[model samples]
Target: MASREAPSPASRGVSANKPLPPTFKSIQDVLNGEGVAKGTLVSVIGVVRDLRRPIPTRNSGGSNHGRGPARRADQSSLTANIDWKCVMTLCDKSIDDENTAQNGATGIELHLFCPQNAMPEVGFRDVVLIKSAKVQDYRFGTSLLSNYRTAIYVYSASAIPMPPKSAKDALKPRPGSKASHVEDDEHEYVSWMYHSMNKDSLPEADVFEEQANRSLNVRDKFSLLKDVGDGGFYDLIVEVIKDPYDLLDKATVWVTDYTENKHFYHHSWDISNAESGRDGDPYGYTTAFENPTTKGWPGPYGKQCLQLTCYEPHASPLRSQVRAGGYIRLRNLQIKYGRNGGNLEGYLREDRAYPSRLGFDVIQKSEFTEDADSRLKDLLKRKLEYKKKLKQQKEAFAGLENTKAVGAKRKDNGESATKPNAKQRRKIQRAQRDQEVQKEKTQKAESLGLNKQVRCESEDQPVSSFDRILNGVSWRRTRENGEEEHLALPFTNIKFRANVRVVDFRPRRLEDFAAGRKMSEYDCLEDYDGGSASGSDGQSETLDSFAGPKTWEWRFALELEDASPKAKGEKPERIWALVDNIEAQQLVNLDAVDLQANQEQLSQLREQLFKLWGNLEECKRHEYDAHLESIRRTKLHMPPPDSSDNEIEENGPEQAGRRPPDKVSNKPFTCCLQQYGLEISEADPTKCDSGEGKRYQRVFKIFGTAVR
Candidate 1:
């Protein structure tokens, strides 16, 4: 049987009279000892698991602690006696008994009460050896405390040849027990560390390089990504579906990888000089390349869309090169969680050298690249299917519209017409002409080898400039059942022609429209009492204050009327629209920036509009005529009083209304229709329904205007 006694100091090669080198003890042994042998000194080796920042110690019963004359009022003095100590938790290599070890062994808490300057420069996972540590009964249990006499030695992984035997046991699985996947992982790690210390071992830098390259090999399909992983590089192949909408020069695009058809991805990438330094050439070229014009990736039909952010400065030039319908292979993109739910976001890895190498690579379908050809085929197939579906939808919608129109006509006419009217024939002809024009355009594009440049029809049409303003147009109406229904016009890009008389033009200061300006500056403009109406004459009133160095936007109110002869009996409508700096510049032939700096140029713009739209006098004449007609129609409805009844005027008996009150104008002002090539026409009031007031209505909120 083996001897059951610990070796004597002499046998252990230490002097018994002095002290034996503190016997190395497992954390378990120290903990189980319960400090009964409190004076005993021991050594422990552990890995620093965590570190806590040094905390200030409070003064105990000092002047600062009590309200006394000796108490220091200055904050500096109050903290003068406070000491900061850092505490850390350490994990010993010893594993609990096999049964409990599987669940993981607990780490021991170490309370380090050292001077701020004396705190150990240890980090997580650093192997540390604490020598001559005293065992004490701490607040909860036995603890090892380091004092002046204690010596701590930290070892780097490369310095340690092997971990302690007990630590190896802790990491290893018990016999006959189900082994975890990572049970032997520590052994591998130890082997690597040992090899790393050898002169013949691979360089540490090469390991990291290998790891980075290996990460690039990870290819994740869109379907597999549920939650974003730790920001790590990934590779993906996708099709660009939308043109980039720039926000602060950052390109935001929507794309589809086609792995799943139900989802779309959005990605934002920076193309500005803000990154990579304004002076640095991102593309490493002496001359910048011109980007090819492309409408955008096509197809509203496809699967999962993902948003990618390109931070590589070199990729700035690729913004225009990547077009709709283009296939691209993105590599070395870092994945991060999106602010919206579990969506994953991709960012270009700009930290690496040769960033452009990993940037978007446009895949051209060619014989040399079979995969590209296949992808192109798939894209074409999807495009065709989408177009077919769109055609079907258009047919269905047209049918529905036709049904509604026929029903309306039947209700109005009391009978459905068997033959199409001349107006209907003209409309059909116009539709055919539009179809022919579209077909011709498609053919021309194909002939010019510009298939890739062919834009969607919708994209070619102008988007409504009034979309943002019109979004606020809403009203409440009472239904037959007495329920109130809130209604708003659905936003659309449909354009209609209208003859409008410019009523008032107000120039907005550039500072007011400029971003980041104080609200107080805007408040000053809001306090202006001037109305947005033309003077009694057709001419617009010149407000010098309205045109200023800060002016950037122009707002105007217009009295509009339908140009169609069919709307001859309808009432004119009034609308307000804003013209932004860009539109204003185009109309007035002066850049807003230049105009803002020169106040004198504003009068020229105002004069030009006055010439085009006529003066307030002309507008007022048209309005007065319309108002008189309205009053005359109202008077006709009044029944003549019977001769037997005495007539008493509301004004008073003294003035029995010297004459029947002439037609009183209910409208405050009238607008000129001649400027819009329109003339007021008389119509039989009996032939028109009261509800037709909305027929000639046309309203717009212009954004930018130039005012003198």
Candidate 2:
């Protein structure tokens, strides 16, 4: 009838009456419900696949008892809340034998709620041993949750923790910490079991090593990239189409597979529906790497064009070495799908060794090389043919312009006796000026050695810079038609400047400009195929034949107003302008990479434009009084010293009595139309003929804007 005493620790299998530590569990075992008892602690080891930025919790109203407004207090408390929590994804090959550690099925997400101070201890690809962590079912699946007693031990590459000399050594309590007793005991148990099970092998010890060792070849064709899972290292031989551009600390390069000579041409002649021609190429075929559903769609393969991202130490030097149109071989590059799920992007992987941290070899093609791959020769031949076709297209366009100019002159002579109105007369004079300007430019180009017959091989040739071809050519005009013929002024020669308020920006979506239905980022390169090019208004226009460069330019509706208005009643006039890459870069102080990658940069651009022109109400109140005052002060400067002055003039007699310098206008904004040798006649500012039946209307193309 007496109560039985509990068994002593020694009787249960201990020599000195000590408690045993919790059993170590593999991630697979934990996920399979091996240790699902409530409040049970389990140990697991894995490589950190992803670590999200720590997100600080919002401060509750309880702390604002003596503060001012809740919103104001919230704003002030933004940095005070240092308690941050983040979710991390960890993976180990043991979880799933069929899955690769990278983008593999063996990964599990863990939620770690901790103070912001603890964040820097862990990073991507770090091997970690998590101890005493509680297992819980999460929205994503089974996940580990770090409780108050959970301990995370991160292993540094240089000093990975080796198994203790003995189980007793690992279990011994440390001197400085009270928590070490439990942690040390648990660590010893896990290490003992791990070594006992695998005979000296540690879990996830080779996780980081596996990625660097496995190198995929360019011939793999991105076939190895199947899921939205783990990323891997790859080697590629690609041509640099877009050079490395910076975005914050990282640099990006756009490349294409040069060895794959698959001729997937999207031609204008193959378009099935002329009505929907402006929408997209109907008969175009998609590449094998893209979505299977879009097999016949008009778009480039995601594989054909891969974006390389270089970070930290690799970015600066890699950006300098890569150049557009150059063939380069990249090795040990990291490949991962972007967040947008469109294409597989590559990045330069930092190597542990010195001297060769990143691999990038610029391949200089040589006709004399005896062992060159046949594919390389074919690539060169294709490039030459493409360039030749581009040259022919340019010459044909120029010749067409010449014929239109002659026809315009004959028409003007026949209609001279009709007694044209002021607007009509202005149009006729503008036409005459444009004709002369075109003829002069044609002759000038020839004189400058822009050979009409062959491809312009020299970079110094005016034709080599495709700005004019991509955008539009410039022309001169007379402000007043009947004014002295000698008074005709040339348009502004520098990048076009304009004093205009941004009335509206088109295409609110970034994809509309870069990955639209009808066009890719470089669709303008294919404009030489003939037929009417798509215009900003979604209409076809033969006159404005060249569809502007894709992604390089943004269409904006601008309100062209005098920076310094002459009258209080003056109103702004609306015009359209195509802002090309260079000007957009200057205006927003951002490159295309940043603009496309970050949506916030687009908002920043709009804010910048608003700051320049001011909002609608602010712009309306802007007056020219200050500008007038500046002009007055400029004109009142004292005349040059007379001969009586002691200082000797260079040509004393002739220069002694020279007048003051000419007074310059204090205009609020520079006129881009004037800078580019172009203008809209005052008689009819709505539209003007840009030669060859092409009437450039309300659209005012601005290349740059003055800083406010």
Candidate 3:
């Protein structure tokens, strides 16, 4: 609905006040409080230097100026629904001189509040005479307000008449203006002021037009929070998701347009149950595991909200008016990279070009009517979508948790070995059962337990294949009615105990088991260097320059093959699991150091590992050395770099890749395995540009199996 222009007071038949003699004060005198005090009624005449369009005021209920009951829906008369506020600045010859010297507007500001459609029709360079305006001292500065007795008179700069000889010839005040009649002295004063001011010479005239045009341009450039980029200004319509927090000079408020930005800080809700390291413990088993605090994050979840800092003048008003769940429009909001350069944040500072007008406003409910701006409509749609997405996320998380509960219940009842979805699980159960039957038949009753070795604490647990352990839990997807449904989960809380034989050990040799630790300023506890292990010599200049002690720690992996008896045609399964310093120390019963120079500890490691997997290390070493020799022979012959393996195999016996000298003569050992995930990309989940399109990857690590 269009806003209605106020009707004339004469048209409304308002009785005129008795004429009073004119008493005008200089703008300088009024501002300095030389004679007039705050709240004192005074009169002044000046040129209209700047003005703003009428804006709807907060609906504070009061008398409706005898306009009958307010019909806010009356499209023809917006004044019937709400009060209007118009702001303008006035400066006369005395103040204009000062403004000219300073090259800015130093005029007295006037705040007028009246019934909607009753705003005074004044324009730039016009002469205005205001009477009975009450001086007000606001927190920001001093200003003038309209009272019941206040009256306004305007004389067009090009149309003011010469001195009138009679009362009938004198100009009369316009409709809706409270002035009874224009005094002859006031008429002469207006005429002289109008002639004295040069319309082309006024600087504030351009300021008023710039402010209006700037507003339209900014609104046209409205952008969603998700599309915001660094070092650009944009206007935004956002929902305040969290209440504004006050700072001494600035305030911060978190808001969202319901679109996710990857650079925004990730907020995890209690239901999402984000993973913490060290086997998914809620608080983590050790201080070395970095856990993100999940408490007190009032979330739309994920990366949907942004924190905006409002400075000084903007902060004061925003803190008082904006609340959680309220809607607002921010103009010329700036986006920039925050400290450390990873996340993006917003900033709102005072606009020095127009200090009187703020860059933000509380969006009134009435403005959201059917004909509202398109930007506002988009904001409303996103808000609804956000609510729906939040609901779906919670439901998906619940479904995953429920699935885990059901699996645990079945395990407790000894039903885990029953027909399972994974074929590998079924094969493992059958193989272990067959071995158990054969052992019972061949061993004497008294010596049944003598030869068997229990390497892991959870040896009594069911033995699972590498395939079953890797696929223990996954993101299950299904389609019904053409809509694909998938669980939205951060990580699954699941672990496994597996019977496996060590077919290969990483570093390919026992001498490289211990590695130099990477030093960092924030490092206090030992970190698990699984994916990132320092391979350089401990005497590197980077480590030697450190003020703290240089150290070496064990970091390596074991490639294990499932040891369960398999069907004649079935293939064995293999997987790699990391063994960090703590787990390695338990397995070898020695502290880590530069193992190549420490023959005593190196020999001890070989002996200790012998009990877990007999002669497995020796077999792996022999195979590795032969493979290296073949690679050297191929390079010495200078074979084409891109030669196929088939061509190289046919070259000669020296180029043939040698197989393991002997089968791994190791007994199967039961060890605990943990399946977890690490985030590979913090980018948007919708984009699957490469293999990293998924945000995280599943990782398996060995834990809790000590060598005897």
Those runs of model 3 whose alpha carbons end farther than 4 Å from true positions after fitting are 1-46, 51-88, 91-124, 129-154, 158-219, 270-295, 364-381, 399-708
Query: Could you give candidate 3's per-residue lDDT for residues 1-708 as a string of tens digits?
Result: 333454432444332222223577877677777788987889888777777655544343543221112222222323333366666778876564534333244678787767655667776567778888888654335677776677877666556643221222323346575645567666666655544433443545566676644433322446788899899887787888766766667877788888899988666665444332322122221345333452244557778888788897788888888888787878778899766477778899887866765667766555555444455667666655565566656656757356677778867977555556554666689778856864543332222232144356665555555654555443443456666565545445567776677778888778898887544311221332322222221335663554454467788998878765665889989888889888787777788878888898888888887876787887767666557767887879854334355335444457556433467777776688887777576567564322445566667788887777
Model 1: residue 606 alpha-carbon error in angstroms: 75
Candidate 2 local Cα displacement, residue 130, angstroms: 4.6
Name the candidate, 2 or 3, with the larger lDDT value.
3
Q: Rank the candidates by lDDT, best first.
A: 3, 2, 1
Candidates' RMSD to native: 27.9, 21.9, 26.8
Q: Estimate, for each residue in 1-708, the C-alpha lDDT of model 1 and write its tens digit.
A: 232444443554333232112346666666666333775777666665544544433332211111111111122212243344444555543432233233244545555444455555654355555666677543223566555456555545434443222123323221122121222333333333222221221124454345434433322332222223646565455667665434333454556654442222322122333333311112222124323343223334333466666654524644756766566656555676555544556666454532223355555432112222333345444434444555566556657347577668866966446777664676799678756754554444333221121112223432211122234444455578989887553332334322233443332322222122111111123222222211221355356534433333433334332221122465544455445434444444553334444556655654544443445433454455546655765789854444322224222466454433233212121111111111223265533322232222233433222222
Better of 2 and 3 by TM-score: 3
On lDDT, the candidate that comes out on top is 3
For candidate 2, the lDDT comes to: 0.44
Question: What is candidate 2's TM-score against the reference?
Answer: 0.31
lDDT of 3: 0.64
The list of candidate 1 runs beyond 4 A from truth reads: 1-234, 245-250, 257-304, 332-337, 340-345, 351-356, 365-376, 400-708
Best by TM-score: 3
